[model samples]
Target: MEVAPQLRPRAGLEVVAGDVGEAVPSYAQAFQVVVNIEVKPVATVPRRTPGASEEADRLWLEHARTAAVIDDEGCFLVRGADRDWVRVRRTAHTALSAALVPGAGSMVIAMSPDGRRLCALTEEDDDYWIVVHHFEDPLM
Candidate 1:
């Protein structure tokens, strides 16, 4: 789960042009080498309706018809009720209007390595990789 400066509730960080995929690595054409760093990995984000696998998808699709970047350990944050700081992976699916719905049990954002590709960061073979893909696929 990519944590950004915006993930912080009270601190006001300037909007800067950068991406974690770009900030920390030489992206493989396959996006396999990109790292997925956890900021608050201990989070257990509350469920809006008791489902992150499906409802989470609905939330993102309804807003922008894009894939969601789910933190493996996403939970309630100190600030922004139900709000979570998600690292947007680079992808073609961009949210037209982004929203944070803690009541629904989460804070969401559409992001990318370069802010242009749909990505899923996973731990496979004991290593993290930012896998880029279309927004229509599951995190499996």
Candidate 2:
């Protein structure tokens, strides 16, 4: 019997866009993958007044979604869901959408090249992780 060498992913390259609406190139050059993030400003909070003077407004992102493509190797996409993905910073207010709640089906962490395996990132104990998943029936 013979065994093949193991392969692992290199540290992914980073891309920064000036705005959330900018287009990201689909071609994978000099990198194993490419990623972009989308964020929306949902709230404005006032910081603690210094010396009882004027306070500054801090913007908060209520929703954030990230998309990634690994050329022909694979792809990844995920969104921050549940309770608007953020709370009012330094405030006791929480925003819960009555119409658009994040659900399990809307999340797509990653997909295998052969389309056999799926991956997802889950939060546990304030830590995030990649969890590979298998489907009972492979989609066509």
Candidate 3:
């Protein structure tokens, strides 16, 4: 019996939207789909400030919830059931939440097409930007 040669699969694409509240104007949309973790309710904390994300950690660990925040350098997930603050880490996969860059305080979250890398929107000067990285496969 003879076997056929295998073919490579193609990557996926997606479009993401920023959180738009009732009072603020909206920003441009980002087209990406490498990694896409659900926007857990994340809480923001001061970068390098002492125990900044403690509150967010408390809620997540004690209550099992997530929050949306700009930066999450040293915060913990508040599960609402335990006293320990579950640590958060930068994913090798892609993420699209607002985060803190090295020196840019005002940067938008940019995800890779595959959802494996993370970057900032203001880092580039494009009208409609889409970060191309490794993303988590969605089960549909």
Candidate 4:
């Protein structure tokens, strides 16, 4: 995949605005696929921070729920029990509503087990970024 000129490794969290697709795999290599289920699209807003995604991965997963998989089309998908799917979808929607920028598009979303930290992969003008959102309080 061609990297967008504007997208470069930065110090803190990286942020973006818009839809993202197709490029997630390269960045999500360390994430193991937990399941594969069809997910409905939810409205998303583009927001970002400047930090190492690897760092977020470690911190987020230290207490994260099973990660939700976003497809090339930006829809959520998981391969697991019905309850797991429901939880992931619910968490995705709640996270989007609470933390995202408020726009029409799809993004990769992973929630902490406690439903507080949200890690989203978003794209804009062909450039992709990973943004992490930490809610002062839990969403549950």
Q: lDDT score, residue 86, model 3? A: 19
1 against 3, candidate with superior TM-score: 1
| lDDT of each residue in 11-127, candidate 2, tens digit only | 121221112111222112101221112211122222222421111111111111121122232222222132101111111221111111123211123333333333333222222
For each candidate, give its TM-score against the true structure: 0.21, 0.24, 0.19, 0.29
Error of 2 at 137 (Å): 2.4
TM-score for predicted model 1 compared with the true structure: 0.21
**Per-residue lDDT value at 73 in model 2:** 23
**Model 4, TM vs. native:** 0.29
Once fitted onto the true fold, the runs of candidate 2 whose alpha carbons sit more than 4 angstroms away are 1-108
Q: By descending lDDT, how would the candidates be arranged?
A: 4, 1, 3, 2
Residue range 1-140, candidate 1, lDDT tens digits: 33443333322212233323333222232233223333222112224335443443334333222332322322111112232223332223332112232333223333432334333323333222223343232222
Q: Measured by TM-score, how close is model 3 to the native structure? A: 0.19
Backbone N/Cα/C clashes per model: 15, 0, 45, 12
Q: Rate residue 40 of model 4 by lDDT.
A: 18
Model 4 agreement with the true structure over 12-68: per-residue lDDT tens digits: 212223233332232232122211123211222223445333433333333233332
Candidate RMSDs in Å, in order, are 15.5, 19.2, 17.5, 15.9
Q: Which 10-residue window in model 4 sums to the lowest lDDT?
A: 78-87
